[model samples]
Target: MSWFEYRNQVLCAESVSLAHIAKEVGTPLYCYSTAALKANYEEFVDAFRDRDVLIAYSVKANANQAVIATLSACGAGADVVSGGELQRALAVGVPGSRIVFSGVGKTSEEMSAGVAAQVHQFNLESKTQLESLSEIASKQKVEARVAFRVNPDVDAMTHEKIATGRRTDKFGVPIGEARSLYELARSLPGIEVVGVDLHIGSQLTDLEPFKKAFSRLAELVNALREDGHDIRHIDLGGGLGVRYRDEQPPTVSSYAELVDETLGSLGCQLILEPGRALVADAGILLSRVIETKQSSERVFVIIDAAMNDFLRPALYDAWHPIDPVSEPQPDANRDIVDVVGQVCESGDV
Candidate 1:
């Protein structure tokens, strides 16, 4: 069933009405539909039902325990960047072996937590990070499974701030340097070289970047095998986008086909870390108008919400279709009003 719809001249979430939620839970509330989240998650997993894949929900998109726990219930793992996220995953019953830790700057304490939890693999971002993780894991007397995240030097063609695979971005190692890193990891006492990882960027609508990055990764995988490293898993870091407004992102099934066609011959497990694609549409921010004012050149509708309640609009100038909780009458007055938050910032709209 559609999680959000209109019934009896009112907006509803699942079986409950948004107006009812406003009266009880109050406005300026964030609501998520369990059915919607589970359906999207299951759809992604079903797309890879034929492959050895682990769909790890990216927690950075929405870290609510209920959200994580819902995905966890659907057998979803977690792709976390911080120790707190690891803890959150664990708390929600996402085991350590199912978690993949990825980030550019990982504190020693954070590394220790991961080493303690024994996460699935650490997506090695830099040599310095690898060195620190190796030392920490050796002290803990455990072999840390690692996948060297490589920059394929492909443009994701998404927002510049979100694009990660470019050469100038502070992300994974250059594609040309993966072999040397694999050799170096073999020499380390605490690291086990297991797989190759590459994520172009987030909110990517084009499949070309994924194809290019995966093709490069396929070539590198064969090279690594020739170098005698047991490349078991190919962590195709996830950036499959979601429909925030009117985006036409590639389907998860199509992405799976691309992976199978490009690198499936390597006989390696595939891992995807989807964040926004899974959760963004599953949730909604509820607010109410406080007042309506008109100036000489403009009209404004002040809402009870603040920019902090929903930062995407201010952060990325994002667009989300807004509608009245109660359907506006056909004969209702109409005006072009700039709906804004209560913040003092000029951009808090």
Candidate 2:
């Protein structure tokens, strides 16, 4: 079921009458629906049901333990970036093998900790990083399963800050250089190139970009295969968009269909790293009208929640629809509110 249906409102995060959650849990409280989370998770899983897939919930989006525990209960592994996220995933019963670590700068200490944890793979970004991981793995006496995060050089057509796979982005290895990077990994004694990873961007609304990214990656995969590399998985790093507004992005089923049509015959395991779509709508930031004031230019509905509570708006100048639970509703009274939080910063979301 859609999160809208589950929440019984246009919003999916399930704010319990606004007043109730604000009064009980306190204003600025974050509320998530277990049902919405599970349903969204299941939808993604079901999309790739016909293929060998492992959906790893990205921990950076919302690292709440209660939410992670719920996803863990539904057989969701974790895709973590930092050491703290790895610890959080482990704390919530997600096993080591189920976790995949990805980041640009991984410290030796952090690498040592993840190596000790024995995660499934580290989505290595740069050659220097790969070497560092190699040295660390050698010291620890372990074979590190590493995947080259490839920059497909495709435009995800999303915001600049969130875009990762573009040619100019400091995200992954350039698509043309994957073979050389793979050779480098092969030559490294402590590291094994087990898979390929690509993350174009976040808040992507169309499938064409993904298809293009995957198509480019497929050629590289086949090239590696012909070169006698035992590539086991294709980690199509997730950027599945969610409805923060009325528009619809591709459904999980459609994405799965695209994957099936594109690379179903490759026999490599499919791994998805979805963070926002699965949890963003499943969770809602609850705040109250702490005070209302009118200035000469405009009116303000000041609330306790701030950019700190949910940083998306402040970070991206993103839009989130707000409503009042109390009655005396009027269409004329509503307008674009510079709804702000308690942060002392002048630019608060």
Candidate 3:
């Protein structure tokens, strides 16, 4: 509410009232603050001003055209995970050199598109993918600048669904296996090993996991250099959480300090792909209270928005604060009720 505040008893995004938006664009709407997105992007950029850094906005969080264009205009790159996102980044004037194609499963067509685009980096997750990209890059007459999404196996202690860098998870190569893969990549005709990458998890409130993972990455970088790999960049895949509720995640400045301490000595360009930290707070879903039903077990306050519109609540047990556009009266009746969407699923809370 501090950012999207109640001005004169009405919720406003910056200075524009939400009620006016609903009247113009209809309800069950998604609203975002350009100012918030710009500020968040700038804050992260300012933190790493002392070093060579690329702040690639993770498009998975919010693929809204305006959001992508806003960041792109500000000289921010993109970290896209799919072909559609890659095209979106391009349509918004993001050069392929500024986009990093990530994700565990990328189709051959996607790899070909990435090759055609000559993206900044491909975060390869498996041997099969390595061969696939090599074939495509060679056929397309392009050297794919790539990085091994190294699994440090450090538990980020966040939600299991979003955690990527673990021994058990089907993500990046294990730290033990990365060096050999780098050698294999060296032998490949069209694969250029340019960087190391790792993403432990999302919604991380602790910095210890980052310190552990980055420390391991630094060690791996030294080993890679000793082995004559021209490692020029490090993609410390971003999962710095935002305060959807009361979680106190690390600030950009503190995280920058850890980056400087760990990878600064390696002299590699730094890349970060922040998702929720950039977009979650900058936008909100606006819905209407449809009806209220009372049962012996519970009171259900049904809303017009469904699980399909915003799935994080049911999908991740995520909590996003819902507030009335108009402030409640001091004497308004206080009731304990289950606020829910109109989805048919029982877990659509």
Q: Give lDDT per model, in order.
A: 0.90, 0.85, 0.91
What lDDT tens digits, residue by residue, belong to model 2 across residues 190-227? 89889999899998999999999999989999999898
Residues 273-326 of candidate 3 have per-residue lDDT tens digits of 998888878888998899999999999999988899989888989887889999
CA-only RMSD, every prediction: 1.1, 2.5, 1.1
Q: Would you estimate the TM-scores of all the predictions?
A: 0.98, 0.93, 0.98
Q: Give candidate 2's whole-model lDDT.
A: 0.85
Better of 1 and 2 by TM-score: 1
Clashes found in each candidate (C-alpha, N, C closer than 3 A): 0, 0, 0
